[model samples]
Structures are given as structure tokens and as C-alpha cells.
Target: MKRVLNVPGIAYGGDYNPEQWPEEVWAEDMRLMREAGVTMVSVGIFSWALLEPAEGEYDFSRMDRILALLQENGIAADLATPTAAPPAWFFRAHPEALPVDRDGRRLSYGSRQTFCPSSPAYRRAALRITRALADRYADHPAVAMWHVHNEYGCHNAECYCDTSAAAFRVWLRNRYEDLAALNHAWGTTFWSQWYYDWDEILPPRATGAVPNPTHQLDWRRFCSDELLSLCTAERDVLREAAPSIPATTNFMVMQNFDALDYWRWAPELDVVSNDHYLMSTDPESEIDIALSGDLMRSLAGGPWLLMEHSTGAVNWQPVNRAKRPGELRRNALAHVARGADGIAYFQWRAAKAGAEQWHSAMLPHTGTDSQIWQDVVRLGADLQALSEVRGSTGTAEVAIVWDWNARWALELPSQPNGELRFQDLVRDWYEPLWRAGIAVDFVRPDADLSSYRLVLAPNLYLVDDTGAANLTAFARRGGTLAVGFHSGAVDENCHVRLGGYPGAFREALGVRSDELFPLLPEETVGLTGEVAPDATGTLWSERVRTEGAQVVASYTDGPLTGRPAVTRHTFGEGTTWYLATRPDPATLGSLLDRIRSEAGVAPVRTTPDGIEAVLRRGPDADYLFLIDHTGRGAEVSVSAAATELLTGKPAEDGSVTVPAGGVAVVREPRE
Candidate 1:
């Protein structure tokens, strides 16, 4: 289990498209892959058109040479099912397979994922190609892993077509079983929209007025399930061919793309994999990467694969800013530090001409003289040194609750705050924890929280009965619970909790709010309590009336001036706190630091402010990874002698000096 690739070390190559170049270039690519210490390459990600030139016509000559080439060079192939993009001929043959947007416009072919997930024609064609690929190369020695499909639901997540309408009706039948239950759950009596028969229901498509909130939420859930079902179908085909090879589709588990609920999708795959890219606009991309890696690790419950990342810049951003010198190494190693068993990129070589021509790769158009190429070689050697840490696991002192259903229900129309983003609120709490060098794990709302000392719920707008009870029980059982603003206001049906604003968590947090008062975009509120005197809040405020809670921070100025801005409630044996407003970073950091001390939760390692420290435990050794996010060097004190993986040198004086923007992984042998 030490080597996820079934080899000696971590997997290091990326998406390899041999069809993009000439035959002569294929040989050169293989030579370079060996020189760069590449272990495996994902093939045929978007090559459906090449594989099947027309409907029912197959061509494996190009792929045949490529697989043979990989076998000859000793590099493994991550063979992919080219179902993400069906051939143009297939789309032409079945025009109804194209997805229609919610606005009633049928999108034309030409882009990837043009087929509808619920279309029978599309499903049949997709499976046929998957069967062909699996039949041809299931037993090939060069194939190491069976990549089921590319990133699912990236472009065409939802469809309002007639085919999808039928599928939604079927899914509703299975969920509610009867029209009475469906009507009751949807609150159909409110607007006289009750359905006497299942045929009366339609997707919450473009309408004259705002559609029912419950209907809208169910539509999104159905869409996500449709895609998951397709992914499972394809994986079944591959499994029938070869069950030993692990099969997975890349999950987009980062910011801005929250289509598929990975919690529901993770169980369908043989192995969990994710594709993470840095935001060119965000100054703190490293923290975002760390959080994404942690989420992937938590989803897999152990070491997961970093399926795709960018070596420098991605071509899709409006302003594609390339990574500076040594940034790629820092990003890759940070993922490894957070439990990524392997590191890969979007592409192995730069495209000569395509939609992604501007995307950066390990072997850029500038050849082996570029900074990316040099760093790629160095990272390969670094991963080789870190091979011994493949199977180790990362631990967390704190857990953040994130539910895709709650996130989907929170962003519906007609809310207190229109500009409120789910991920932004979660990141606001996560940033401070990362800066303190605290290892954090993300879990679903219903996940068991007894293992973590502290749990934070940041804007969980929709709470099911099980989740609400779980949160309350966790607090009652002596775990510190911190609930953020606008949380616990609604149930699974998107219906308000009637009695109070923060309904589900009011008793647990010992606070109540009958109404929420949102501030203007430029408004600011000052706080007067344990935080710094100049501590301020923004975006939201609430008129708090405590039932059995003590005020921790009061609003000095705002709609709820001189009222409680934050509250602390003592539950059965633990303490619960409610955050009424989003505090600035420093103020939030101070408050969380104090709370951590009170909860007796400590970081993985104590280091300078911006340095990231993560510990991974193994049978014979414990690997400690120190990532210097700070621009300057950081000196970390070690309690015993250790071996630095990157430099192959022993750490002196039980101390390691991490260079600025550099990473050092120390392997400490167990006693």
C-alpha cells in the first residue's frame, strides 16, 4: 500500500495526449517522460473524436502505438473512457442528445459534455464506447489505472429538456413513493401548486415568477444524481472488464464549482480522485489548495490522489497569471503534505493549437529549458524521496461541517443576503485555522463528530433532522461547537424554521433571533468585547435575544447597536458559541486562538505565523511536512533527530530551517 501506483513511489505524470503531436514527437515524448522520472500518464481524456471517427466505427491504431510506447518506456498508462466528449458524428446522429439549458435554448454541439445526462441515446452511445475501450485494453500491461471519465458535470450539470423531465419524474417516484408525500414535502398548498398526479410535475424551469424553493432544490439534487448514475454505469462496464484495476472519475472539489455532491459520488468509485486548480485572483491560493486537499483526503478516509493541477497557469481564467519561480513545487508538495498519494497536472505537454493552448505544462512549448521543466524534474526527485510516506495518514484536531445539500438549498432565490456565498463563509473560518498550522478535516453535517475536539458550522442554511440532532448531541457530549451567521434557519425542505431565525442551533448555542438585519455593501459595524477594541464586522448583523447564553461580543455600532454580536452558551458539558457577524481576519484569528486554548486543542506543530506544518503517522515512521508559505525562511524546532526527504541530509540539533516558499519533509523513525 505504500505505493499507490503499485510501484516503488508516488505517481507523477499527467494527462498525456499523443494524438496532439506528430508520430515523431510521440517517441520524443516518451524519452522525455523517462528523463523526467514520470511514472504514469492519463491517456484519451478528450479524444473521443479520434478514437471513434464516426458512429459505430472504431480506430485504436493511435492508442495502440501510444500504449506500446508507454510499455516500452516503462511508464504506465492511466487509460480513460472518452465519454466526456462524444464524437461529432454521434451527436449528429442523435441530435436530441444535446443538452438544453434552463432558459429553453437547446445548446448546439461543438463543446464538450454536449450530451444530456438523462438522454437514453447519449447513455447508450457512451456505454458502447466505454465497452470498446475496456475490451481493447483491460488486460494491457501498460494500463495501471482505469480512469472512468474526466471531470463530471463541469459544463452541463443540469438540463431542462423533455428527456430530463421524464427522468426527474422517475426519480421523484422513487423518492416520495406517493403523490401525497410529494405534495406535503414540496409545500404545494402554499401557492395552489399541488399535483394530483405525478405527470403534473415538471422541473423548476424558466417560469414567469420565482419557482417553488423546494422544487428548485429537488431539481438540482436530481441533476447531480443523474450525473452520478451515469458515472456509476460507466464504472460498472470497466469493472466487468477488469476488477483489479481501480476506477475513478476526477472530482472538482474546489471553489466555484459545486455541482455534484462528492459525498454521494465518492462511494461509487473504486478510488477517490480530485482535480484542483488555484485561483489566479486569490492571493492566498496556498490555503485554498490545502483545504481542497484536506477535503479530498477526508472523502477518501485516507490517502487520495491529486489527479490534476496546473504546473503554472491555466488557460481558462480571464487573466491567467502564471506561477512564479518555485511556486509549482510549493503547491505540489503542499498537496502531498495534506495526504495526496500522488501529484499530477492537467497536461504533460503544452498544446500546439487548441482551446487549451495557453495552458502551462511540464514540457512547455519552450522545450526543456523552461522553469516549469526544470521544476518538474526536481519535483520528481522530491516525490521519489517522499516515497516512503505514501501510506501514512494525516490527523485533524478540528472539523468543518460542509453539506452539498445544505449548500444547494442555501443559494436559492429570495434570501436575506443575495451576495452571500457558501464557500466564502466556509473559507473565512478555514483561513485562520490554516494560518495557525492547525490540521482541519471537512465532514458532512451528519458525520460523527466525537473524534474532533472542536467543530465549526459556517452558514449551514439547511439542516436535516439527523444533522441538527447530531450537532446538538456533539455539543451536549462536551465538544465545542461554533455556529456562524445565517446557519440553522431552515430544514431540508427549504422552509423557514418559523419559531426563530437560527432554529436548529438556537438551543445548542443558547441564542435566538426572530429577524435578521443585513447591512449594506459598504456598511461596517464595530464590536466591543473580548476581541481587539478596533475589531469590526461586515456584511451581516442580527438582533439577538439570549435565552440562556452569555454575551461574548456586543455590537458597538450597527442595526443591533449595543446588542449581543456573539454569544456563548453552556450546554450539558461543553461550550457553544454563535457568531452573529463576520469578523475581520485578525479579530477572527484571535477569537479562534482563544477558543482553541479553552477547548484544549493544539496544532500539529508550533512554528512561525505563516509556516504550514502537517504530521503523518506510519507504522515505523512519522513524517512531518513543513511548508514555508511565508516569504521569509522559518526555523522549526524538532524534538528528536530526523531525516529531511528533499535534501537527503540529516537535520542537525533537532531543528530544521525551511527556506522561504520552500518545503521540507522530515521522516522521524518511531521508537
Candidate 2:
């Protein structure tokens, strides 16, 4: 059964902390919440210091008052375990629980998430607090869901302390079962680092030279597993206390943050939730949000929650620029368009003092008359208007392969080009699809591909044998496969495939490479012939030869001039494309636009630039969500007459005009 948010329709609210303000202000907050139509708020996420000041010591006074206030105001509480930030007194007792950095420096407790994941003391304290909260709030009327230990690995993902080293060895023993197997997997023979005993193994600590790639990879895998183990441990306690409540921990699934493999973490979650904040510097931030929303939706395989996003500028960035007039609505609706059933922000009220004081909230420092507050109220009403969109989900004909392991390996030391980014490679392809107004979903390389007609794999640097086979079979069964450069070069063990450059996909793509010729900084390669007339590439180029495949394009002027830059091969009734370099966005979009056509994947609805169209189908109707990122309005045509949900107007003529920088959701009833 699909685990859904307990909110009746669209969950509209953010993180609420009454403890930050005086108790007298709680009534006003409740009034404001009702005015904003806020239905749910994550409570007590970082209240460990207030809830349990000392070890095993409990004080539910503050938490009880908050829940009672929520119940009185008709607001649902997304109750949190508050294990993300352990109290200072508890930390003082277990000083070793603090994380040790790679350089063997013991970090002091100042920021949140100071506890090490592998520390026995930290785990015990975290679970005890979780159990206490669960036992106290098991049948609380205001409690709607269980949020287990905030973002699992935001501050401390990998630790190299003595405790972590011991835990890593245990993890390795369980994984390999024997040192001989571990030796083969880690390629210990190269560095004369073979270990006969498990004690000799360490957690890939600060090494003089480039650490063993496989060893580093395994350590990363273990770090993700260790954090997940704690999450499930706390979640299990919650279940034992309150089995009726669904539990989830928010995931940092955005780009620039890649510590934990969310693909593995998603299945363990009762419901997938993600915290996405836009970087002010990113010019294409809107598209990035769409990418993240699709990923969250894909992780849940249906509806998801936008657990955290700012109402405006975030303080963490170097220069925090406030959102343009209509961006807040566009941002929230973009997630809804991508299949998020709930929309929430990081904070409900602005903080008077904190590291994130400048981070904008629903109620900003400017108060009720401010633009941010007005936007919040309007958005609440907007979400309420689109309540019919709940229970509907979007299905994409196109999927982009998202592999955390591949991303981890690509960023490891000693790759072809130090400048190339795995995240950029993904955006390079997805940008074109997004620009073309096509809907997309993210899929793990090994997951089901039958639902998608086109699969875009952008630089899968590390893929296992099973995943490689899965992608190959997906293409063989008539799915159009577009593979990016530097993909399929290494196995899961981080061992290079000896025969060719693109190891696992050489035959599937019908292309082979002798060597990779990385372009220097500011270098550009021109692509001519059949790919695109103006197609140019940057950062990477390769010597590629084709077998049983047509040369779609060739490098017109580069180190590999006149060689195949792009190839198209027909495999088992499907077509496969191989791109040897990072094509400029326009050229990439044009090429993918062609591929999207070859796969017979049509857009849900075509719109102008910066305006996206997506469709979600419910039991009774199909909802068409057209989100406008541009400040200008545009008219879009639909296939059938429908009623626009937000405006409460009928688009009886099979066409609707989206408001400038706003969304227009039209629902067409199922006949």
C-alpha cells in the first residue's frame, strides 16, 4: 500500500518551532496558521535540548503544550524525534561521540548533527530519545506522521575515528565475509595493502597517496548504510510505540549535496521526503527544482513531499538574493506539477537568532504586510485551490538514470578530466528535455525501465554487471537509450574495464574507444555531419569507432577531428545513441529532442520557453499543470475541455492561458 501524508488534501505548511518564541505568541501563530490555511507543521525537529536536557532525563512539558496547541488549532503535527541535535549535557558525557574529520581532528560541538553516526553512545542516546517521543506521543490526536532524525547525513557522513574504524571493519566483514574476498574487491595487490586479518583494515582514513578507489567506494557505501541503520532503528522504535503512523526522514536530494545514496534509503522510508533549497547562483534553479521533484517522485514511485524549501533567499549562500515577484508560487507549483502531494518550507517563522537567521521563512522578519508573507498566504490559498490534484500522480515516458554510486566514483581522484562534474553531465542532458517541455522521471540504473520509452544515462562512471545488463536489456526491448560520455568505464568495484573506454556499454551502444582525449580548459570542439549543424562540445572528446552503427556526427575540429562524435545503432528493435563529448545545451537539447521523437515519446503539452506542462492522472480526472517560470503569460492548448482548478474557471474551449509566472491547473474529467 502507498504510504501517504496524513493531511486531508495538499499538506501546506512548514517547520514550526514555538519554542523559539514566547508562549504568549503561540496564539497569534495559530491564528496566522489558520489564516494561511496551513494544515500541517513539523514540530520539535531540533528540540532535544528542551525535551531531554540530560541523559535518560525526560521533560515533555514543552512538547505536550505544543501538541495541545496544534490540536486546538486544528493543525496536524508531523512529530519529529529530535535526534538530529543531541543535547549538550548528553554530548558532554560522551565526548567521543563527536565526529572526527579525515585529518584526524576531533570536531567540537557547535553546530547541529555533531554526533558521529558510528558512535555507540550516539546511537543509544538517539534511540532513547526517539523511544521517549514515540511513547509519549503514541496516541496524540494532533500527531499525523513520524519524522525520524532530520536529514541523516548533512554534517557528518564519513568519520575516521577509532570507533568508526572498528565499525567499518565490521561492515566489511559482513560484506565480504572473508579477507580474501575483500582483497580481490579492494585490489589490495596494487598497493601491497593486502590484509590477512580484519583488524588490519581501516576506514580509508587520511592516506598519503590517492586512497584505493574501491576502498573509498566501500567506505562511502558503509557510511550511507550506517546512517540508514540508525534511521531504521529509530523508525522501528516509533513503529513499536505507534504502528499507525508513517515515518520518514527528509532527504537532501538536490545537486551539490551528495553524501548518502538516496536510492537505497528510499525503500526503507515509509514515505519519501526531500529537502530542496535553490542556490541563488544557479541561473537555471527552476529546472533544478523540477529535476529534484522528479527524483523525489521517482523514489516514491508516486507522490512525495517537498519537505523543505525557502520562501525566498537562503542565508547559506555567499550572496542571498530574494526571489523575484512570482518565483515562490512557481517553485511550489513546480513540485506539485512533478507529483508532490504536499508542499512545505524549512521554517514557518523567521528566526530572531541562528546561523540561518537570514533564511527567509513563511512569516519573515518583515511581518504580515510583507511580500513574502503575502506570497505565503496566496500560496496557501493556491494549494488549497488545487486540492483536487492530491491522490494524482505523474508517469513519464522518459527517465534519466540517477546513480549515487556512479556519482561518488566519478568525483574520486584520478579521473580522465578533473574539471568535469557528474552533476553537470546529468543537467546537460536533462536541460534539453526540460527546455523542450517534456516530462521526466529519475530511475536507478537497475530499476524497471519498461514504463519509460526513453532512458537518458548521463555518464554512469561506475555501474555493476546487473545494472549494465538491465540498461542493455532496456534498449534491446525498443527503448531509446542515450548514453553520455565517460559512462560504463568502470565496474562497481572501481576496476577499469580493460578492453575499451566505455566498458559495459561498448556492445550495446555499438561503439568502442581506444583512449579518452580530455579537452583543456576553455577548449571547444565543433561537431558537424549528421548530429547538429551548430553542435559544439566542451570539456571532453574521445577517439571513437563504430561497429554496426551509423555515425550520427563527427568531430569537425578537435584532437579527434573527423572521428565519430556521436553514433546511432539499432539493437533488438530499438535504437541506441552514444555521445562522446558534452554537447552545448542547445545542441544537446536538439539531439535529445530527436531521440524523444524516435522513442515516440510526446510531450504532455507543449509550451513556450520557461513554461513547463505536466499531467497527473487520478481515479476520476487527468490534471494538467502548466507552470510558468517566465514573468510573462502564455496561452497553452489542451487536448480536451477542462476546468482550471486554481481559477475555478472552465477551459471549455480546450485552451487556457497561464498567468505570468504562476500556475494553471486544469482538470479534465475521465469519461
Candidate 3:
């Protein structure tokens, strides 16, 4: 079964560190929480030191009170296992708990997420701690879910110590079994990199300003897998003790951590949750948050939660800017519009003093009467009043394949230009569809892509035979497939797949380029097209020849001026389109419009360009979320009159203007 969430109400509140405060303050925290209408609280996030103050001794005295306090206040608590950091005692007792740098330097812990993933000592201690916590709190009525660990990722992929090197060899052995296969996979023939023994394979060349991207990339993947193995270890222990308790790990939206193979990790999770920080109030910011919400929800096709977010401003970033008065509400509603089952802020109250002292919270240290406090109260009240909206599903027919393995392997190309980045390519292609109100899912390449009308894969640089065959079968069965430049050049093992770039997809894509023209950061190319009035686009330019294809756009400048920047080839009832250059937002917007028109893409509503809309279908009725990102009021036209859920006002057939950074959840009766 696809993973799914069942949210009965808008999830509220976030990380609460009662361990950081005096015992007397816990009561007031609960009292203020009642005023803000908080329904949940995440406890023991960074309490590893308190939970395991000594090596062999374990303590839950403090967490017992925290959980009891949450229950007393009638609030559910997201209980963490206090495993993000093993106390200094753990590292001191077992030096193996500390991570080793790729340069062979032993790392000393100063902050969280500092343990070495491959260390059996660390794993043993972590397992003991997780099991202890589960045994104590599994039956606690207030303990709703288990938050596994804080953002899981390697701070520095530099564990070349004996333990890591040995682990790396084991990982390679599992992947290729022997040195001969490893030699062939890594293409050791050219550089005499062939290994006669398993011990000869070193952890990708580490240390330096510009390290070997491919090796570093593999190391990153290995490290992520190592981390996943750690999570799975603890997960097994917890599931054994408390078979029914939900388990989740918080993720940062922009941060890349192969933590658990998302495809593998997601199914085991009860609800996928993320911590998102939106620095801008731009359309891009809204899209980023919405996409994150979609991804989290899509993980198991269940209701996901906003695990952590600031109610106002944040202090961790270089620039700490505060959210405007209405910005918080707009952001929260937008998450709901996508597929969020629950909504929560980063903290219940701001820190009196700490690294994140100034980060915004529902209740500032000033108590519960501030503007943010009042806004939280109003927002909570709104959520409580509209409990009927929970369990609503966003209707999206389009699903974009998002492969974490492809993201890891393909971007680590040995010879690709710096201009091409995996994440950036995804954003450039994804942003337009998002703004156009198209529901886009991030699917793995191996996932069933036949479900969607149009499947767009941007910069598919690493195309394997199985993946190529899947795409081939997808197109053969009448599915429109589109791909961008620098794609299908290499295999999973980092070797050029030989015959032509895009190896197996050469027949499907219908064109081949002899060489890639790398562009500098400042270099610009021109898009020659007569689509939109301001539709010309530019980025990197690629010279290409097409077979059984028609040119839609050509480069007007550069040596490859007349080459087809955009080409289309029709096969059977479906077609394949290749975009050889990066196009600006306007041009991409026009191109996506063409695909939408031709492929019959579905949109929730036909709103103005910058104003995005989504339809949430429920058993009784349908709801539409109209989000205005212009930061200025917008005149939005409605197909028919509908009642605004956020405000009890009636939205009519005539243009209903919406305020800047504002959101409206309107209920439209099914026709």
C-alpha cells in the first residue's frame, strides 16, 4: 500500500524543550499553551544529555514530568528518543562514538548529529537508549508519536578511519561482491585503478577545495546509507517494543540528506513530517513550502505534518527577518491546500537564551499577550472551528518522478559543467508547473510513471538499462515524456554508457550531440521562439541534430545558433520532447502551457498568473485554496460563487479581490 496519513484535526505546536527550563516554568508554559489552543507538543528533542547523564546509568525522571504535564494540559506530545546526540559521557566512555574525519582527524562533539554512523559502539548505545525510552513511554497516553532523531545527514563526509574504510569495503562487496566487478564498475582500466583486493578500494578521494565529485558523491551516498542503517537499527528496536506507536524523523526542506533511502524510509514511517523555513514571501517561497508539503504527503500518500517552522522570524540564518502580520496564516493554509494533515510551528514559546533565542514562536517570552501570541490564538481557533476540513485530499493527476538515488548518483558526474546541478534543474522545471496550479508528484524513476498524462524528467544524466526500458515502455504505451539537456550520458557506476550520450535513450530522445558546451556563470544564450510575447529564454546552449523531430525553439546566438534548443518527436499516440537549453521562467511558463494544452494537464482552478489555486476533494464537497503571492491584493475570478471557509464571506462569479500574502479556502459545491 502507498503510505498515507490520517489527520483528524489540524496538528498544532512544535519542539518544546521543558528540560531547558526550570521546573516551575512548565506550568506557565502549559497555561499559555491553553490560551494559544495548542493541541500537541514535541518533547525531548535535544535531551540526550539528561536522558543518559552517565554511561551505564539511564534516567527518564525529567521526561516523565514533561509527558505528564502534556497529558495534564490535554495536549498530545511528539516524544523524541533523545538520540540526536549521545551524551559526552557516551563519547568519552566509548571513543568510537565520535566520528572520524576523512583526513583521519577524530571529531569531538560540540553540537548535535555528531555520532559516527558506522561505529558499533554508537549504534549499541543508541539502541539501548531508544529501547529504554520506548519501554518507559510507549504506554503514555500523551505520547502520540516517536520522533526518531533530528535532521539526519553527515555534516562532513570524512570518515576514512579503519571502521569506516572497513564498512565501505563491506558496502562495495554487497554492491559488486568482488574486486573484479568493482574494477569494471569504477572504470579502473584507464587510470590503472583496478583493485587486486577488497582492501584496495579507498573511500573516494577526500580532502581538498575541489575534490573528485564522483568519489565524493559516492562517499556521500554510502554515508547516507550508513545513517539509514543506523535509523533502521533503532527503528527495529522501537517497533519490537511498541508495535503500534508511529515513528517519524524530521527533515529540512532545502537540506539534502540521503538519511534513509526516502523510498525505503517513507514506508516504515507512520507520517512523513518536515521542518521548513521560508526566508522570502515570494511566489518561490510559497512554492517551496507547498512542494515540501506535497512531498511529505506523497511519501506514503498519507497526511503529513509541518514538524517545525517559525511563527515569525528565525535567528539561525545569516539574515534573521520576521514574518509579516498575515504571512504565517497564509503559509499554514497553503500547506493545507497541498495535502498537509497537520500544521505546527517551531516552538510553543521563544527561548529566553540560547543559540535560537530570537527564533520566533507562538508565545514570546513576554507571555501570551503579544501580537504573535494573539495570532496563534486566532489561527488555532480557526483550525478548531474548521475541524471539518481535515482528511481532505488534494486532487492532482500529474506526478513528476523524483528519484533520490538518481539525485545522488547523477549529480556526481566527473566531467559535467558546474552550471548543471541536480537540485537546480529540478527546481527550474518544477517551479513553473507549481505556479500553474498543476499537481506534480516527485516519483522515483522506477516508480509507475504510466499513471500521469505527462512525465517530465529534467537532466536525467544517469540512465540505467532498467530505467531506460521503463521510459521506453512508458512512451510506447502512449505516455508523453519530456527531458532536458545533459541527460542520459552516464550509468549508475559513473562510466559513460558508450554508444551516444543518453546511451539507451538515444532512440527515444531522437537526437545526439557530439560534445557539451559548458557555460560560465555569467554567460547567456538566446531563445528564438514566437510563443509568448516575452517568451525568449536563455541558459546553457547545446548544439544538436534531430531525427524524426520538429524544432520548436532554436538558439539565436552562439556558434550553435540554429541548433534545436527545443524539439518534439511524435511516436504512436504519445510523444517525446527534448529541451537542449535552460529557459527563463517566462519561456518555461509558455512551454508548460503548450504541454498543458496538448497533453490535457489538469489544474485546480484558472487563477491569474501569480495567484495559485488547489482543489481539496472531500466526501461532501470540494474546497479550493487560493493563494496570493504578489504581496499585493489580487482580483481573482471564480467560476461560480462559493463560500469562503477562512472568512464567512461569499465569493461570487465576479472578481473577488484577495489581499497580498493572503489565503482563502473556499468551499465550492460539486456540479
lDDT of each: 0.89, 0.89, 0.74
Q: Over the full model, what C-alpha lDDT does candidate 3 score relative to the true structure?
A: 0.74
lDDT of 1 by residue, 463-524 (tens): 98899999889989999999999998888988788788688998898888977888788788
Ranked by TM-score from best down, the candidates are 2, 1, 3
TM-score of each: 0.98, 0.98, 0.93
After superposition, the stretches of candidate 1 with alpha carbons farther than 4 Å from their true spots are 1-5
**lDDT (10s digit) by residue, model 3, range 54-114:** 8758788888888888898889988887778778877777787677766677888877777
**Regions more than 4 Å wrong, model 2:** 1-3
Model 3 error, position 259 (Å): 6.2
**If ranked by lDDT, best first, what sequence of candidates would result?**
2, 1, 3
* Candidate 3 weakest ten by summed lDDT: 1-10
Which prediction has more favorable TM-score, 2 or 3? 2
Evaluate residue 30 in candidate 2 and report its C-alpha lDDT on the 0 to 100 scale. Answer: 97
Instruction: Please give the lDDT score at residue 296 for candidate 1.
Output: 91
